[model samples]
Target: MKKTEEKIIRFIDAHKLIEKGERVLVAFSGGPDSVFALHFLKKFQKKYKIELAAVHFNHQLRGKEAETDEKFAKEFCGKLEVEFFSAKLNVKKLANSKKLSIEEAARKLRYQNLEKLCKQNSFSKIATAHNLSDNTETVLMNLLSGTSAAGLSGIPVVRGNIIRPVLCVTKQEILEYLEKNRIAFRIDSSNLSDDFKRNFLRNRILPLLRGKINPALDEAVYRTTSNLKSQLTVNERVVNHFINEFTRKKANGFEIRLNIAEVFGEIPGELLKVLIEKNFDYEFKHEDYAKINSLAKNHKGKKVNLGSGITVIREKELLCFQKEESSLTGEVEFPAGKKAKLCGVTVFIQKAEIEANPAKKKAYELISADELDEKFLLRTWKHGDIFKPLGFKGTKKVSDFLTDAKIPASEKKNRLVLLNRNKIIWVVGLRISDEVKITNKTKRVYKLWTI
Candidate 1:
């Protein structure tokens, strides 16, 4: 076995990238790197006890060259008797539609196609041809563009179902192996031109750095990134502990208690940044972290819009990181003996006799059946809405009632109210109006509850 192959096998074994009898799909672009990966996997298919297949994606950017690459990839797979799948994507159109760079759009389409193929064929692992050279380039790009430690950690060896088995080898090793084995692979013309950022780095910047500074830059980067990833794994455990302890998942987004800062006083902003990233998948800029920390110390009701539909509001002693909710409109009619779903909660009304005193019960509210019409309107509580509490004589604003109940300001909009003839009869899961309370004179009663 060659040294490159042995290294890849060792990496795969260490990472548990593939299991026995697992179906592995290789992303074959007919380029040197991907072709070598497919060849290497095929060489050890029986030894690994795995089924192998290949997929080729045509980005449609190279016109005739793209079609040729697809054809070559199909023929290569045919020659090896491996299952082949191919897809042609209008990457330019996708880039324009999504307002993303051409490279980003291509990558998005490529992964989408690969995942789709995996689901259709029940593949357990999708292997991409990301080598040590790719990782080094990524780390350098992230460093140049200003990134977090996670970005500097480079590409993950195993992300969910995707694996990079050849990550242990470098581009030089792949080229040398291909040459020694008399393998033919197609070259992407786009890669030769220095039009893309990656190509510019590969052709212009990396060579100068390697010649002038470190000749072994790739290995050095690989070692550094490996260490960073290990440290990140440990940090992730701590972040997850904090998140599970202090954060609550709501319908729209996440609610993080402000007490987390006191719990983790050592650079709590970093923890909050990671927590927000985990929930919203948005990377916060350096200034955003300061803004978040500032908001944490600011007065309640203060908020910072973090773009991308994400807003962090300070509600009393809690920090609510939530997506902007659309205007709450529309109401549903709740009929007797039937349930109505309004604003994520199911409101049900059924005719029944009051089994226990309403004051002693917390699960459901008992309302006077004679006061309600044939149906009731269930809708979100709006401003200026007033309802009389069961124990109070005068009417109170629903907003004030919710505030008195200690509900977070961010959650008040989702609170539902049941109305009879435009009069508030019950605040769902909270309290019923004094007018609807069952009394000794009431003959029939209705039970209302929410799940």
Candidate 2:
């Protein structure tokens, strides 16, 4: 075997990533790394008795460049008697629709295609040419974006069905191999563009670090990340403990009390978010943690607004967290001589005489500057959580109201009901009681909210 081929075999053999006679789908982007990877893997295929194929995803960003890459990859595979498959994806459209970055969209699309292709073709393993430089860039990018220890630990060399046989090699070594072997490959122009966060790191920050610090900065950082990953092994145990203690199941899915702000002090806030998302597939933004942390020092009963209609209730001893079932904005209305709560606003309404402003922050609704309420019903809609829908004298299942509202299944359990003396005044963001809507005979207005 050639030196490069021997190195590739040794790396994979050390990891035991590929079995003898296994079929492999190699992710070939037609770049130097992937092209050299394809060349070397083909060299070793006969000895291992492994069948090799190339899979390419055209992200449609570089227009003809993707097509050029695909054609080149196909021809290269064809010349070597290897199977080739290619797909085109609308990466930009996917990114825009999902509100994700272009890099994220392209990555997600590429992986999905790889996964689908492997499933269809019965390939047991997928190989990529991510190298040590890639690992360093990944760790740096994650750190700049406030990643946890897990993120700093760098990319895994082997992840399940995916294997990076070229991970031990550096980008410079791959280039050297391509030059020495007289190999042809296409360059992705997007890598030169600074618009992407990763490109910025790769082009600007990485070079500065290399020039200013150690010349072998990539290896240094990779080692640092490995040590950090090993060091944080103990933190995972404590994280699991907090994850279990704070989470609970309600009627719907679950809620996390998140009172462990004191228990896991040194851990980055991102880990807390990870724990929540890992357990419940739910989370708040980074700044939301700052808000929650501030509340930890304040008095109890302080409420916080979490997005997607969720609310964190900071209690004296524990935080009682739940979802708000209504729109964060918009209005609720009530009429003459009746009591109600604007279901969406979570505020109560009563008919009274003309006087004050109607819009107030907490637990109050629109009446007229004229028709105001003296008393009203206040609660969230519950499953057996009943609500008397407006214009109807009878109460319906709060679950039914949610169904009619088309509330997402994940959020169904969180809708709160506002009841006045056991009568449904409002369903909170859905419908208010008909008896309390503004009428021609309304008289007053009353308002409330703390400045």
Candidate 3:
């Protein structure tokens, strides 16, 4: 076996990234690293009896150059007698739509397409050409971007079904092997542009660091990353056990309730971080972790919203991670004598002559139509909003009233308030303004009901 092939095989064996006879899909971009990966994997395929296939994704950034790269990849795969698949993505459009950087968008799209291709073809493993230099660059990026120990550990060799076989080799080695074999590969012009952060690191920063600080920096970082991965594995097992013991599936299995006092008391923050990330597949922000630590230390009824409809509420004894219910539609216009759907409630207003029943409170409030000067507006309760309760003497802040009524904070935003000419008339589903209350002498009434 050649030296490069031996290195790759050793890494694959150590990581258990592949098994004999498993159909593997290679992400071939016709670049040096990917070309070398395809070459080495094809060479090793005969020994392991594994079926090899190649996939190419054109990011549609380099215009005609991208088409040429796709052609090169397809022709190369044809020459190797392997099945080739090609996909095109408008990366700029994707990035603009998703509000992601070009690099991030391209990566996400490539991986998504690769995963779909693997599933469609029944391939067990998806191989990528990430090399040792890639890992070092990632570690540096993570550090510069406020990362933890896990981030410092660098990218995993085996992440789910995606395997990086060339992570064991360097970019220099891949280039050397490709040159030694006289293999032709296309160069991506975008990679040479240092406008992107990764490119800036790869071209300018890393090369300078390699020349001045440490020539063997990549190997040293790789060793540290490998050690951290081992430590992380042990930590993950312990954290998962803690999570399982303290948490119960809730909300039709959409959420989990964790006994914070029992499980996380005196526990390290790192374990808690891993617990949430590993189980929920969500990364907690810095403030979120701080709030969690506060929950453990103080055991107060505090809440932290982790975005994406996910909220973490810290009760006295338990912490609940729940998917919040969608709130009512924002600000709906409610003209008098007209029924309109607002906040998932059909609000109706009509001037009616009705007898007041003393025994039963009206399902819909009967308000004197003359009292309302402008159209009723249904919207969320805002800060500094004041309204008089049906029988109250003085005005009360809507927030204080909700707090007194023990309305959970998560549901407050969905609480609808009916306003007349910017005046609070009703806290919908709760109470109506005293000014709009029907009286014994009332003849003309405006009926307001949410169905």
Task: Indicate the worst ten consecutive residues by lDDT in candidate 3.
Answer: 251-260
Estimate, for each residue in 1-451, the C-alpha lDDT of model 1 and write its tens digit. Answer: 8888889999999999989999999999999999999999899999999999999998888889989999999999999999999988889997786566798788878988999999999999999999999999999987887666787899899999999999988898999999999999999988999988889999999999889999888999999999998999998898778878888887678887887777665326556677677777455566677777888888877889885568888898788888776776669985789999977799888988876534664788778888668778989998999989999999999999998998876777789999988899988888999998777789888888988
The numbered model that scores best in lDDT is 1
- C-alpha lDDT (0 to 100) for residue 260 of candidate 1: 74
Query: How many residue pairs clash in all the candidates, one count each?
Result: 0, 27, 0
User: Model 3 off-target regions past 4 Å?
Assistant: 241-327, 330-400, 415-451
For model 2, how does the per-residue alpha-carbon lDDT over 1-451 read when each residue is reduced to its tens digit? 5676677778888989888989999999999989988888898787778999998888887878778888998999899899998898999997786566787778878888999999999999999989889998988887787755677888787777999889877788889888988999989998988988899999998889889987898788878987886777777776667667766655423445545555665324655565445534243356666766666566655667654445665554554445544453222333334444333332433334543454434344443333223344344454466656776777777787776776644455556554444566555556665655655665544332111
Per-candidate TM-scores read 0.82, 0.67, 0.70
Which scores greater on lDDT, model 1 or model 2?
A: 1
Per-residue lDDT value at 121 in model 3: 92
lDDT of 3 by residue, 195-231 (tens): 8888899999999988999998899899999999999
Q: What is the TM-score of candidate 2?
A: 0.67
